[model samples]
Target chain A: MASADNVGILGWGAYIPIYRISSDEIARVWGFDDKIPDSIWVEEKAVGAIDEDTVTMSWEASRYALMRSGIDPSEIGAVFVGTESKPYSVKPTATIVAEALGIPPKKLASDLEFACRAASEAIRISIGLVKSQIAKATLVIGADTAQGAPGDLLEFSASSGAAAYIIGNPNQAAAVIVASNSYITDTPDFWRRDGAPYPEHGEIFTGEPAYFHHIVNAVNGLFEEYGFTPKDFDYAVFHQPNGKFPLQVGAKLGFDREKILPGIVTPYVGNTYNGSALLGLAKVLDIAKEDEWILVAPFGSGAGADAYAIRVTDKIEEKRSLAPTVEELIKRKILISYGEYTKMRGKIRKYER
Target chain B: MFKDSVPKYWRLRDVVYRLKYIYCRDCGKSSFPPRSKCPYCGSSNIDHRYSKGNGVVEEYTVMYQSEARYQDYQPIVFGVIRLDEGFRIVAPIVDVDPNSVEEGMRVEATLRRVRVDGSTGLIQYGIKFRPSRR
Candidate 1:
């Protein structure tokens, strides 16, 4: 595997849909007790507008990334969209993104699926592409309008969002990846069968055997491989399935609340499926200072995790402001009722027939 | 609600993504949904000029019972937009109340999904205009 430190991220951007649905509203419909919020550690989740989907959100994010990088789209050698909830099962979402950005036909493009951590896989591939001289620059995006069965527990955190990163050489590097590690297995703790509208989970099985194990094992492996301790990092971001999972996993891995909480947005935006960890990383990049080391661990159900050690550079302070910040998007909220959420989600359209 | 072949849509993408219009230098007329032949002068002498996607509403209408993909956005609104650059084109008007729509409203073109074919068919994305806040 190519070391993350060898490749640098030139730009980064985040997108959280403006619409939000409160957990209390979901509780009202499902008749769950008031403890739901505390239990799930989510107050609300971002919801995409009727016109929005993974592709559109990804476009919004990648455009910002391009703005921050200030690079010509034609110069981008590869484009990758990592999402399980892609608009078409057979078609390539990357092509639409490339075409929208006016990328030249000689570039490479493809969609990646690994439940939630698919975008991390794209990042890994991009590192190799840039490092091996295969590509001058690459675009990797994680976006999803995650679906949960109408009233399932998954609904609590299944949300819409996207994050994009442009990886290039140190000439424009806003941040450097110092180390990287990945752990994966065929553990089916959560999944949606082919053509199914929503995903099904093992419920209790998702927690112990799936998310925690993969994230922990990957982070530990990265630490062991690099001979670094938790205190070596100034901040930490874990795959935020909900607000709670990242916090709980961080605590178990010997990280402080202050270290983990800075990157935790799932409390307000829910889990954006593929975008979860990447968004967390983008938010951290927005505020992190030069020489600061941050740890990132992203887990995907059925199940795997990629652990990264990143070092913020002087370029981050300048490039971060060139594009929209995660905080700015979070502040520009338009709360919606559950009925409105269902309408925007297009649930009513298919149900009426 | 419009659907077409993948090749046609692929070709249209370059036009809609940037609002690229072919300028008929012969008559100095510009049109969108770019034409190979000039609509005014019958001249093939043309240049591709990109629109800023900013324009004003010249005419308007509301549509209900739209296509399957657009059913959720019932009462779809559309209008004729007169571009600042001396051309008129018809497109969807969005981000406004149906009752509030009227003539002479300022609008800006944005990319949006137009329609989808069968349950698992091609998705057509195109330019739609929203009332310009500016």
Candidate 2:
């Protein structure tokens, strides 16, 4: 996982839609018990408005990343968007987001799909690009306006959000990538067929086998390959499908609960799919002190997991406030009832123009 | 008729997405929706430049009733923004309450889904003003 050349994160940004729907509201609409929210460990979830989707959210996040990087948009030689809820099935969301951010044409751009882990793969690819000098900096984004079947359990956690990262030279980075590894298998825990408005999950089947297996393997592999242990790291951020999962996984991996608390964001914002672990990393990056080590693992339900050993640099203290923090974005919210949530999420069909 | 056709939107994407405007070297003025000729000086000696997308709201109105596709965005606050770069553009104000909008509030541009041609059509994204976080 360690490379010859030094590559790291130059800047990072996150976007959570301002609209939110409480677990109680979702429970009421689905005729579920009041204890369901507590049991799931999700209090509320962010929702994209009728006028919002992956592309728009990606742009908002990338724009902030560029601001923090303080580099001209033309310097971005690659832009990759990882999303499940693309507004258009045929058109590439990456080009639209790159164009919106004013990145020039002399760059590589595309949308990657591996469910939630797509963005982590994008980051891995960008590391190669930067390390090889193919691109001075690459923009990697994880964004989704995730969908859940009407009245299904997935509705409680499927939410919308995005997080963007600028991967560049370690000298100018806020955090350097020490090591990384990936573990994947063809196990089908969740999936959405083509043209299906919402996704279908394997209910309880999503646990142990899909999420836990890949994440645990990936993290253990990184530790083995890099000769590092959980105790050596200052913090751990795991892909959070729900609030309880990250904590459970942390304890399973020999990490203290406090070590994972700073990065657990799903309890408040629900599961942002692709944005899940990346958003947690962004939140940790916002507050992590210089010289601290952070371990991150993101899982996607096809399924796969990517683990990284990130070391915060002195540049972090100076660059932390350059853009809106994850906490800032999470705190700025307006709650909506189940009726308004359904309307905004387009659960009820409307007139065709 | 496809008013927001793919080609039509694609052709003017720089203008719509990035607030690209024409700068008249002769008159030292700028105009948005980038025209071939500068409206101020009728000068063809124009160069394209992107706005920082920071501005002040000059005037605004709230539309409670919107077009068919825009029903979900009811009470959209439409505003005339005076950019610091010396150009004015009309855009929708979002992410805030219409009642809280003021005549001289600071605003910044953000890319958002402006419209979709239809269920299977292209999703149009463009700049919309929001209350500045700075």
Best by TM-score: 2
Compute fnat per model: 0.31, 0.78
Candidate 1 per-residue C-alpha lDDT over A136-214 given as tens digits, one digit per residue, 9 for 90 to 100? 9999999999998788878888999999999988667888887899999999999889988888888789998999999
> How far is A114's C-alpha from truth in model 2 (Å)?
1.0
Shift in Å, residue A84, candidate 2: 0.9
Task: Give candidate 2 regions above 4 Å deviation.
Answer: A1-5, B1-3
Interface DockQ of candidate 2:
0.67
TM-score of chain A of each: 0.97, 0.98
True lDDT of residue A108, candidate 2: 95
Candidate 2 TM-score for chain A: 0.98
Cα RMSD (angstroms) for every candidate in the order listed = 3.2, 1.6
How much does candidate 2 score in TM-score?
0.97
Task: State TM-scores per candidate.
Answer: 0.89, 0.97
